[model samples]
Target: MKNRIRDLRTAKGMTQEDLAEIIGVSRQTINAIEKEKFDPSLPTAFKMAQLFELPIEQIFLFEI
Candidate 1:
């Protein structure tokens, strides 16, 4: 899986910490997601989509 979290967050002028707070996750979790080392749960994905006003598919891309 790959994600546009880092790009989106930065484009929104939010730091990892800021995004984490809004999404109700740890900053490290946000970092991990941005690094593609972690995949967020459905709820978390939904939160991100809501925050960004985009579809989950737009943020996270599944190659397989």
Candidate 2:
């Protein structure tokens, strides 16, 4: 999964820890997501989309 999490977070003036706290995840999880090392769960993805005010597709780009 290629995501715009870091870009969005920074654009919103949020740090990874701040975003994790807001979305009920860990900072490490946010880091992993930003690094594209792990894919988030459906619920987590929903939380991120809601927090970022973007559609899931906009946050996480699926490449085939």
Candidate 3:
């Protein structure tokens, strides 16, 4: 999976820790997700979408 999480977070002036707290996740989890080393769960993804004010598809790219 590819995501624009890092870009969005930085654009919003949010540190990983800040975003993590808002999304109820650990900083490491946010880091992992931003690095594309881990994929977020559905609920987590939804939270991100809501926070970023974007659709999940806009934040995350699914490749077949």
Candidate 4:
């Protein structure tokens, strides 16, 4: 999967730590998500979409 997390966070003037706190994850988890090195769980994905005020489809894209 791919995501617009880094771009959106920068656009919102948010740091990885800030977003992680809001979403109840660690900074490393957020980093992994941003880098596409890890896939978020369904609940975490839902939290991300809610936090960003975007649809999951808009934030996340499947590569295959």
Cα RMSD for candidates in order: 0.5, 0.5, 0.4, 0.6
Q: Write the per-residue lDDT of candidate 1 for residues 1-64, one digit (tens) a residue.
A: 8999999999999999999999999999999999999999999999999999999999999998
Q: Give me the displacement of residue 30 in model 2, in angstroms.
A: 0.2
lDDT of 1 at 9: 94
Q: Model 1 off-target regions past 4 Å?
A: none
Clashing pairs in 2: none
Number of backbone clashes in candidate 3: 0
TM-score of 3: 0.98
Q: lDDT tens string, model 4, 1-64?
A: 9999999999999999999999999999999999999999999999989988999989999888
Give the runs in model 3 whose Cα sits over 4 Å from its true position. none
TM-score of each predicted structure versus truth: 0.97, 0.97, 0.98, 0.95
Global lDDT for candidate 2? 0.96
lDDT tens digits by residue: candidate 2, 4-56:
99999999999998999999989999999999999999999999999989999
Model 4 clash pairs are none
Instruction: Compose the digit string of candidate 3's lDDT tens values, residues 1-64.
Output: 9999999999999999999999999999999999999999999999999999999999999998
